[model samples]
Target: MTRPSNMREWSARARAAGEAQAEPTGATLIRGARVLDPASATDRKLDVLIENEHIAAVGEALAAPARASIIDAHGLWLMPGLVDLCARLREPGATHKASFASEMPAAFAGGITQVLIPPDTQPALDTPAMLIRVQRLARQAGTLDVRMLGALTRELSGAALAELSALKSAGAVGVSNAAAPINDSRIARRALEYAKGLELPVHVFAQDAGLAGNGCAHEGPVATRLGLSAVPVAAEVAALRFWISLVEDTGARVHFCRLSTARGAELIEAALGRGLPVSADVAAHQLHLCDTDVDGFNAQCHVQPPLRTRDDRDALRAAVASGVIGAICSDHQPHEADAKINPFPLTEPGISALETLLPLTLQLVHDGLLSPLQAAERLSRGPAAIAGLDSGRIASGALADLVLVDAEARWTLRPERMLSAGRNTPFAGRTLRGRVRATWRAGRAVFRASG
Candidate 1:
């Protein structure tokens, strides 16, 4: 099958085929790539023929069409491009921190084709126009797909609910308050009820504000010794407990964001056992770093739901493997150089994650904690399911969003080499295995590594 030339024609063809597949500019033959589709439980050496941005066929030693471009992918691994559930592509307000122009390269370099942008910005994404503006910006940039997440509360203040239905109609995939904790349980419950009535998924960052007051690091020996206010693991557990009850009462679907503690995972698992409509994700950094990583007051280690103890980290790793935790995200917040000039306690919390997401994730695979397929699922299929997206699987009649990886390739992290404006990653100077060789969206090569 040939792909359509534009989205309109593509949609028409997709509707007729009962699938949403992008139309490529021409037929593309990817030969001898190890194709892995976690959603379909497929892992094998195969040849994939993409026509009009949709996969036309997959088999061994498939012959290429006469005019199709051939990409010799021997020894490389091909899979669906990643779908990120949480990331702050600072735009509309904090362009200096990060923007579409800067973040897209990082996203593409990391093999992420679609990223869900959070509502935390100067003018919160609370209105249909705001949501549309971000979409327009992404389209203008002409790179990866950027999905908008509208604010659950007006202005993300958590004081009042936003126009949920209108935001959805404006193309918001889901709603969230970002990291702004809703102190009023009543307002939170009402928001969930409204979302339930409209059948929208609500993404919540669980944290009890009062309990997490002025905290700059995890509440443990590290914070105690550093003389900084700490956010205890109990803060997350408390907020999750309250939110779980509301989810049960209102029957609203919820996705708990950045689950960092052992007890927190236990709460979500118990909720799932009872069949409450819920899912959860952990930050990739949380799985790899802990309170110990914050020693010497390394400002980059500061993150919301501040990295917990090693016990918590081990538990989170176990939860992800056991299927209790569905996804892993970069939580990719890019900060300007001066953002960390202040004292460690005063510096902002985040790590520049886009460039390092894949390599760091593959570390788990190297350690025997997660297989390549399992890790890819957390990065692609799992997050896509959480956001109700359509781009995280590869198959006939599906979107041609894919990435090719040199799974055993090694690279060193250097801030100057990163595409993002933020140079705040904790992994600088570290050697990481596995690197993206190329990435495609709708069968067009959007990013290709230089030799």
Candidate 2:
């Protein structure tokens, strides 16, 4: 397979030339905003000139040139569009529940320009043909740039490995099975070895299925008080330990998806310290809520590998702050109302996050837990690196996929106003800061706030 040459530098040069010639008529100048590019490690107030979908310049007082579209960006923050590592757009067979067309608008509204889709779709994305079909569908849907993670095992049964080489060739960014934990160590080892040989990253939803049982909530006081089945923390910890061992043995790139327990973070940290090629992410919901939030037995809080204790939440946040956790994903699993309106045990797990991910993450910035750059790292560059995409940067010549945000802007999350088909979000009516004003993909304005 041929690797695409880096075109970011060339993209910048083209933008500059276009702006120089067009500025005499008029240029679109985004003035006086704080620009943060995590990849470049740049954080400062700068004026950005965008001409024909490329960044013409990123410095102080660049003239708008003639006839340019002027975007007043005072009190705004401009950064690369976020790249979400773990998002579930239930398309193909489950379009009635959620579709790429619906999820794209929500993703763009939340400042996510690119997303790595899970392998849990209908028919399961276990083959190269399936991966290509999804990519084509996403392009036709015109929401956000969507890449697929091929299934690690055929049918996601965890009994037999899929064709990793064929899947990668078909444009699968990585391989995963969503929350389908691999129970057979031998099968898991074979998958890892194949991934290593292909140099493709393997995304593992680390959790011991047997230990998790029929648990509906975190194994803690809340579950005991509510008389709910509990999913022990050991479930996640044990699975992560086994995954780390496999990663070390095969030297395969492994990504632990949405780690929800404190012990999970500790194990990941220890593996990283031991120089194992491992990386992990935490869901935005898990980072913000604890098992205590499940007091009412709300199914919205009923996520798989259920939310953990307060100590676990704090530890997860610290892991993110300390750089042990590299990315923050929406894990944006969307379900219909019927799927979630039932009792906790019978209802499906997960929530809609495409519209809520950015705001909730910015809450971290508001509370002084992370610098804007750090937030950008987790929201953009980190995920891009994991997916091996040439995005998540503001360097000249990079793909002009970017987002303009008003970090100080505050608003209430109203599910009724969302563009997503699924309205099962737990953050409905919650107030949040930071809103995306405009989003560009491949040098085109795919989304802009209607005012």
Candidate 3:
């Protein structure tokens, strides 16, 4: 499909794709579930009724509608299905590691109904054609809502501005360079100005190429002892300062992705305090792990914005608690086993985190850092506002996208038992509390775990 000139046309194409996400099926009633909707600050017992593709009603016990399939939700927590801001579904060319068939269920099992993918896929999503292809492929997956982030530079090469207007018209929610670097600050300023004109938010990775050169681990005592090339915290802090200046000057909205440093989070908090039209999200894994996790050259812990000190992790947790970090995402990048089988420095950096996003976020609650309501806001509502998606809520007339969670259920993470095709997860074999009992999208059950 060619790039349209306006959003109406783009929206029409989106409607076409959404047609496959659900049929106008019969009604369903979830009874006696403790409903938690962070958007409305709602937390109470409610019986939710679903008809067709939207929530028909939500209140105390309403008589079940005729022909509705009734679910016994006693002791279950019914909340809006998660909206993950950063999840890499390896489609369009990286099927050697993952595919829509594998990752979709992984997302559903984790209670994720929507995902925002970056532009760093194989071949990169730099054109309207590429956007349309992923949209079509997601429709075929039939279990997830996918939004694309357009490449800030053509092919994410950090050279020239891409077709930003064309990308917006083709349904890109925002633009980013992904994990790739913007080597030139002049180019970064131009990007913010250009996206501002179109009102598109620029997603910043916030790491300077010069400060982060060829490093495999965080510059800390741990890396020094391990004899690994070290990446200093200044790499993230300097890049964030430059981008905040651009946002302040250009009046552009910028969302920092996977911020991994304490001082960088302080900079972002200051930017927000000054009302600079800036926001930020942290990956869930960063809040729990630190440079210490890489002590033995464990490749599974290798990630962009290499995990820093325990103090940094504590500060990040506090930031999220104090509302400095607006969202928590899974910086999920899946790789084949061979990709991580080599020597530590040579191994690709990432974690197959689709199945662990929600559980990890809930961990903050278990640790007394974030309340359950705060977790819902960070995981669902916060990312929704950042991406400008009309989702991440449960109310009358809203889309019937929801998750049934057994918040007290205990489970173990076994890569071999995971639905994701890639078994490259650092959380493997760890036990965790809370599990998704079922996931529904547009009034139809996408995934329901067997008892």
Structural similarity to truth (TM-score) of each candidate: 0.93, 0.92, 0.94
lDDT of 2: 0.82
Which segments of model 1 are wrong by more than 4 Å?
A: 1-24
Cα lDDT tens digits, model 2, 1-451, are 1211223332233233323322222246779888999988999998877666567777888887787778888888988999999788887887657767656767877788899888988899998888878888887666467889999999999899998899989998899977887778899999999999999999988879999888999888889999999989998888888888888789999999899888899998999999988999999998888888787878888887788988998899999999899999998887777898787789998889888888888899989899999998999998898889878888665777778998988898877777666678778888889899887766666667767
lDDT of each: 0.86, 0.82, 0.86
List runs of model 3 lying over 4 Å from the truth.
1-24
Supply the TM-score for candidate 2: 0.92
Which residue pairs come into collision in candidate 1?
3-52, 23-52, 24-52, 24-53
Which structure is stronger by lDDT: 1 or 2? 1
Q: Candidate 3 residues 1-451, lDDT tens each?
A: 3433333343344334334433456799999998989889888889999898899999998789888889999898898889889988888778667766557767888899999999998889999999988899887756588889999999999999999999999999999999898787788889999999999999989888898999999998888999999889999998888888888899999999999989988998899889889889999899989999997889999998899999999999999999899999998887878899898999998999888998898888888898888888898889999999888788999998899988888899988777666678888889988899988887778777878
lDDT of model 1 at position 375: 85
Per-candidate clashes, comma-separated: 4, 11, 0
